[model samples]
Target chain A: MDNKRRKFLKMAGATVLAGIGAPAVVKLTSVPALASGSEQAAAGHGSGHGEEQRTGIRLGMVIDMRKFYGNEELLNQAIAACHAVHNVPEIPGRKSEIKWIWKTGFANAFVAQSQNLRSETVKNSQFPVLCNHCDNPSCVKVCPTKATFVNEKNGIVAMDYHRCIGCRFCMAACPFGARSFNWQDPRPFIKTYNPDFPSRMRGVVEKCNFCAERLALGLEPACVEACQGTGAMVFGDLNDPQSEVRKVLSEEFTIQRNAAAGTRPSVFYIV
Target chain B: MIEKTLKGKPAYWIWLAILGTFIAIGWACYFRQYVFGLGLTGMSRDVSWGLYISQFTFLVGVAAGGLMLVLPYYIHNYKAFGRITILGEFLAISALVMCLMFIMADLGQPLRGLNVIFHPTPQSMLFWDMCVLWGYLLLNVLCGWVILTAERKQVPPPKWIYFFVAISIPFAVSIHTVTAMLYCGLPGRHFWLSAIIAPRFLASAFAAGPSLILLACLVMRKYAHFDAGKEAIQKMTTIIMYAVIINTFFFLLEFFVGYYSEVPGHIHSLEYLFFGLEHDGHVYNNLVPFMWTAALFNFTGLGILAYMKIAKVFDYRLVGTAATLIFLALWADKGLGFVFAGFVPNPLEEVTEYIPTLNELGITLGIWATGFFLLTLLYKIAVGIEHEVEA
Candidate 1:
């Protein structure tokens, strides 16, 4: 009986070791290959041409609230342009709303920056808030699948809707409340279908993708285009000192939504 | 051994039938949720996780609580716990099944549940949670079945079983710790951001888990004609006493840090839960009564337990009452209070109150029923085998 127990222990030990070690070995060997494959896929999908792919560029936005202050129409136009292009639903209730770009009061927009003694105009103003596309995005960090990931080449936080398990950990992790889940089939709510962009299904999380498709086609984001000439919204590489976004940042005193969150938001607001 | 579950008294079958009906109703509600999307639940964009996740969190503790028995019995060779160690393992098994079921029910795309495993991202705490939960489940199932089978054959479980037993000790701890990490690691959620969340989880888990085991033992004694032994019950009761005390202390620590520090982020959720937050003149205090009730039950249960321990009284009825109270207190504290409060005064600092829909409650009840159904079968088998061995 003792000998039999010893043999059984040996077999069990071997099986246990094999079970754990096998996965580790497979993960280690396959990781590099998978990483490269995903990068290539991202590059291919992000920009049709390799030359157009903005490498080493931290894509960011400068929402010059100075230009947008008291002009709710421009804010509405920007929201409409982005939502129309992205096929975001017009779900009425706040419970099942899907928004890529939206407007909120200054206090709601910048909880950390809002002061009790702020000027009436500043206090009353509404700000456009979207995904910050943070350099240290909490959403990406908590995503179980690499469904939502930072575009390493350009620093634009991106999403792969198909891969998303819709666990909403990202939604919880995101300090900005930028991400939205499709609580219902969003297709029925889309008033005018935009065939250019595919509508998300009921069980995926989506947010501002920084208009990766338009960027692929060598065009500015729809929101930026809609706000063109008004110069309310500037979309450019934050890495390039000469870029309009950087120029705006240099000239204006700007702040990020919840900078205290330590997400290092790419989107800045000039209050 | 498997056949033991097939033989049961009429009451046993009736109990199972009732559980089956709840399970059926829950399945029907879940089908509605799956068809219409998660819109059926009270969760909004702000409050993304709701009752399902809350139950998942609490059940993880209940599952981990099983370790209280396993560690003392196998590692320390506490012979009093010998007869009831399998009970702990079996309880853990059923609790984990409920945990997994809750997760599945909560998922937006249930079909894509395997995506976490298929593309494992180590950075995601959820991936680690999934890993640990599944690992713990497998370990318990293996250990419980092997040990129970050996006991049935009137032979010692092979020495090799000790290896799995040893692993499951930490595996049990890891399951709850990892589950805590899921909430605590998030950046902006102030309620879950505290360092003590993991320790508090273990404390409550230890309390809740053993309280449940004691209750089960009581039931088994009366109905199933199985006694877990007086010494074993006494030891377990003592463990619960300390555990409940520690759990309450940990919560007080959180309350002190939140209130004394005067951080709005920290205090808002707690205030919302207990006293109700005054937002724009209207007090959003839906959870206030529930929170106070939990507190009352917790303190009252602690009082009873302390009295019993100090007075050296092992009155079964009093012990049973204390156990039930402690279990319910911990359930409300960890389940409803913890998860819901975290989402309140959301990251945007907006109050979007979430009240689970009737369908949602139906689904929640169903999952719990499914868990009890599993527990009944597993315990029936274990007790039946023990009875046969004695006969």
Candidate 2:
């Protein structure tokens, strides 16, 4: 119906409002004026500039080894919190993977340490693993759809499982091996549906969304809260100097996992 | 038996009953998989691809393998293959059908299988494999259809169909080459990431495919009885022998590179398969033994078939056995080992061995059964009407 009216107006030359006698009335009656009088008119012009401006809120994290003492409970708490909030699987099986967060050693544990020595065996160490939310994440580049994307809002690299086709290319491209494909539907165990995190079906790939929901709610991530006594993970806005992560990163030396890969990971760990 | 008249057979009913029963069982499992997700399959994070994919890969080699026979007869103008030429084309079509359907059943999201179609990524080898396999299938189908239609009408086909056949000749070679490229392109996989992988795949396809076709022709002659002409198979055996020799040579090349380079990633899978992983879940069952058997059969078959020209009393059986051995040997080396050797010593260089569960084996059997049924049905239509054996 709208298309027909637009065609009729186009045919009558009324589509081009500049030629109309009442320019003021045309401006007032325009879609912009109808959208939100003065504020929108000003904001719309500002939005053009807004898109050009780099977002100042560059979210990041810094891990301080001064705090960690090999506490599995604290580590488990942090991992479970992130998983719970993000609807990561409570089940621990092969075929049904629902891991938004997991664990491994410094050597085998990818992300911050792809080439760390100890390929042969372990050496009294463990680490919580999550999406580094890399500046140039390999997972994002290889995605067939723009399902995996880095948002400018807070520089969080997020995954939309609904848009995922589960080709497993993202899994292959991820230098951190952060991505996992949904080999099975993830809906059986939930007594009630959680609106915060969307459930993924079989045949789509998924990864950590970096607690975008908690960020929207103006709350710290579940991992951050659980890391309370653990002292290892220090998640905060790296853009703000006053932020704990920023302060920690500035005062202490830190390195990224597979720094040579050139992904420029956001997660910082002192290993 | 098929030539006397259109008559009834007990084997047909038994085949139907067996196929129907298995399809029903497979459908039940497929439904359970749909409801629960890939949870029904034995695959996990570590073992991402399981038996379904392996079977599909093996079947594709078997299908595209038909090109080995098709090329010598049509392209080289081997007059010896006269009556048997149609039989090769017929077997190729059935094998291709089985290969494609097996792939369809392997998907976790079988319904969204169209995503690969609707949104194809050219960079992904999966897309290219789909293209090559489909191209080979269509090319063979059109060539066979045109030729058979012309034979039925007792007239020569339009000149272009033969040109299409000419194009399909090299294209048949490309199908399995592209299939190997699917694995060869993956960088991290030490076993699959070889340069000779694609050429080696073609070599095996030629050796195994024509040998299988020759054996199938013999079976056709023996049962539901059609004289697919022995002379054509004699020429086909020649092609098979050459292919087996090339394949064996390329196989040796891979071994030389792997051993000389001493790269752990390259050597690990080979070590695990032959020498056995000194740790968990390591079974040396049939790895070295089967490999040597395949080599022995190929060597002996090549000597007999290429020398006696497949006409010697013993040559026929040796060629058939060699082809069968090559097919099964490549199947194990490529399929099961392809999956197992890939993730071993783990990508992270950790040690997590794989043991396929019973559920996984059941699904694999179900898919294989489906492929066989499809082959059976297609060959019935194809072999029944094959009067293209012009003297």
Per-residue lDDT over B1-391 for candidate 1, one digit per residue giving the tens place of the 0 to 100 score: 7798898899999999999999999999999999999999999998899999999999999999989999999889899999999999999999999999999998898899898988899999999999899999999999999999999999999999899999999999999999999999888899999999999999999999999999999999999999999999989988998998898899999999998999888999999999999876778999998899999999998898788878887799998999999999999999899999998887667788889999999999999999999999999999998998999
Model 2 Cα lDDT, one tens digit per residue, A184-244: 6566644456687777777777777767666555445678767664557766545434445
What does the lDDT come to for candidate 2?
0.62
Isolated chain B TM-score per model: 0.99, 0.86
In angstroms, how far off is B140's CA in candidate 1? 0.6
TM-score of 1: 0.92
Could you give candidate 1's per-residue lDDT for residues A1-271 as a string of tens digits? 3443233234324433464321111111112212322232223322423323323456788888888877888988999999999999999988999998898877788877646889888888888999999877889899999999987656789998899888999999999999999999999999999999999999899999988777665456889878777778877666544455767788988888998887878898888
The residue pairs in collision within model 2 are A112-A257, B81-B232
Best candidate, DockQ: 1
Alpha carbon lDDT of each predicted model: 0.86, 0.62
Leading candidate by TM-score:
1
Which CAPRI level is candidate 2? incorrect
Q: Per-prediction TM-score, please?
A: 0.92, 0.77
